[model samples]
Target: MTMKIKKILLTTDFSDYAHYALTYAVEFADKFKAEIGLLHVIEPIIAPTDFTWESYDIAELEKKSREYTQESLDKIIREKIPDKIKATPIIRYGRSFEEIIRCAKEEEFDIIIMSTHGLTGISHILFGSTAEKVVRKSPVPVLTVRDPEHKFEML
Candidate 1:
């Protein structure tokens, strides 16, 4: 069957690895003439039981997180992604893999593209892999770009 990618979801953690994946996503979007949706998921903040954390504090933290995520997204759009590519920025608070899968399914993205940290051995066992989890759980196709260990041309 022929695959038609109308909408592409690109998940980023604002790390070097994620940025590397952005290059691939932009290239694919340009070639396919697809709209790009950029998503950044922030882990929910847990209040310490020992210290009485006020609701206002939590609110402030959420505000800051949203602002920071927006700024980063804007920077990528302005500097990395080309103007011709239709792109939207989204910020959510939750588990990364779950949030990504939810967004991809709910937004009706044709595919999800994200970067893998390329961790292995004990570190991989301890930290697990978000991309791996999403690949298994996501309803749509998931494309995982690994760290830039191999030289590849970027369009």
Candidate 2:
């Protein structure tokens, strides 16, 4: 059966693994002639110190952080994505997997392509795997890419 993949959501953590996955995402997009949605989810940093008018301070911090993030996103599009394929940068603040799933559903993307950290043992138990969660929860198909060159070895 032929699948109509008009839109593809590409997620990244700016890691080498994610950048490696971009190669696959780009190949898929080119083959399907689909537009690419580049998604980067940033979790808010919670400070331990208590402060007056925390919201204001947090808002200011968020603004500056987002500005740099948007530029990073734009740079990725300009440097990595080809001229033939259409790409857009999307930034969302929240849990990575949740935002990825939410964006895929809200934007009606055909699939989500991302890199897996392949976390194991303690790291896996403590942090869990974002790609795994997205695969299980996403409303659309998920393509998880692993960078064969990078491996996490336990000390």
Candidate 3:
């Protein structure tokens, strides 16, 4: 069966693993002639003590985070992706997996492409896996790309 991919959602944590996934997302977007929406989710900061900062201070922090995230997204588009590809940077503040799923559903993305950290065993148990959670909960098809460091035989 043929699938129509007009919109592609690419999620990143600004990590090397995520950078590797971006390459695949770009290739798919090129093949399908799709518009790419690059997403970065910043976990909401919670004050440790009862004495909380003013709303203005919180707003400033969020603004800075958005600016930094946008810069990073722009750098990837300018340096890595070709100029012809239609790409937009999206910044959302919340839990990574939740925000990713919400964006994909709300925006009606055709598919989601993201990198997995490839954590396993004790580490996986302790930290859990964002990719795994996203894959399970995502409304659309999710393509989980593994880091290049985890080599596998083609056979």
Candidate 4:
């Protein structure tokens, strides 16, 4: 039996590294004749509890940030994605991995395609890989693409 994919979730962090996944996602979508849901998750800013964070206008900042992100998402679809392929712009506010999984489940996407930055050491410890977390927990299939520029060297 052949697999049938109708909808695809393409996750991006708006980075050069994340752009790599677009190629793979497009190929898959083209093969499956699927629509692409371009998703971008905005992580909430964590302010220090003791630093008088209330003085800052975080709500306004977040609103502007979301607006900016939406524009960027649309731009990507308009420029990178093919006209023949249907694409939707999706933006979520919360943890990156959590939002991705939740959106995929809620939208009933056939598969999730995203780029992995291959974080290591302290950087990895501080901000864990979102792609890795999604792969571990997502009930749906996840396809992760690594940065083409990064090469694993023998230690």
Candidate 5:
């Protein structure tokens, strides 16, 4: 059977695992003639009590996030993806899994690819695996990469 993928959503945390996933995402997109959407979701930062509404700086945070996202996007576009594949970068603020789901639904992407830290011990307890939650909750297929093994295929 022939497989055709038009759009793909890739979520990244700018980690090493995520960089590996990005490589796979780019290759898959190229092979399928798909458009890629790269998303980075910033988990909400809780401020101290002393930091009131006036002290809160949403704009600055947003600006920093956008700059970082763009830097990441530029790096990937330059080093990872080939000229044949087209991709867009997106930055959002909120829970990671929720933002991923929302972007997938709203963007109507055919595939979702991301990376997992494969965290254990205290780290796992503190920050739940976004990749795990995404795989469980995503209505569409989710391709998560941890190690650099196995060939990537669309499900």
Candidate 6:
């Protein structure tokens, strides 16, 4: 069966694993001639001090983070993707899953492609996988890249 994926949203944490997912997302987008939306979520840094606002330079940190992520995203597209692909890079601040879902809805994305952290033991229990939560909560189809050797699947 054939699927119509006109708009695809790919979320990245700017990690190597996310780069893998981005590669797959780009290949799929190119195959379908879909518009790609690249999103990077900056997880808020909660301060322990009572006067949290003063403790951290939130604006400067956020600015740096956004700039770094945008550069990385731009580099990936420039180095790996063809000139014909339509894409945009979006930087947002919030919980990863929430921001991803919000962007997907706001951008009218037909699909979401992201990489699973594949955490184990305490880390997995303490911080649940964002990819898993996104799959459960996403209104549209969510594609998660987990297995290191598995091929990308289109749903």
Global CA lDDT of candidate 1, please?
A: 0.88
Tell me the tens digit of each residue's lDDT in model 5 across 1-155. 87677999988777777888888898889888898898888777666666476666877877786788789877877677777888888888798889999999988998899987632347567767788889899978998887667466999
In terms of lDDT, the poorest run of 10 residues in model 2 is 117-126
Residue 55, candidate 4: alpha-carbon lDDT: 84
User: Clashes in model 3: which pairs?
Assistant: none
C-alpha lDDT values of all predictions:
0.88, 0.88, 0.87, 0.89, 0.82, 0.83
C-alpha positional error of residue 137 in candidate 6 after TM-score superposition, expressed in Å: 0.5
- Residue 40 in model 3: lDDT: 89
Candidate 2 global TM-score: 0.86
Enumerate residue pairs that collide in model 6. none
Root-mean-square deviation of each candidate, in angstroms? Answer: 4.9, 3.6, 3.8, 2.2, 5.1, 4.6
Please identify which of the two predictions, 4 or 5, would achieve the higher lDDT against the true structure: 4
Q: What is the lDDT of candidate 6?
A: 0.83
Point to the candidate with the largest TM-score: 4
Q: Write the per-residue lDDT of candidate 2 for residues 27-75, one digit (tens) a residue.
A: 9999999999999888887776666556567778888889988998899
- After aligning candidate 3 to the native by TM-score, how far in Å is the CA of 42 from where it should be? 0.9
* Model 6 Cα RMSD, 1 decimal: 4.6
CA lDDT for candidate 4: 0.89
lDDT score of residue 143 within candidate 4: 90
Q: Poorest 10 consecutive residues of model 6 by lDDT? A: 117-126
**Which regions of candidate 6 deviate over 4 angstroms?**
50-56, 118-123, 147-155
**Deviation from native of the Cα of residue 137 in model 4, angstroms:** 0.6
lDDT of 5 at 89: 81
Q: Which stretches of candidate 3 lie over 4 Å from their true place?
A: 50-56, 118-124, 151-155
The Cα RMSD in angstroms, rounded to one decimal, for candidate 3 relative to the true structure is: 3.8
Model 6: per-residue Cα lDDT over 19-103, one tens digit each? 7888888889889999888888877866666675785786787778778888987987778667799888788889888999999
Instruction: Please give me the total number of clashing residue pairs in predicted model 1.
Output: 0
Candidate 6 at 99: error in angstroms? 1.0
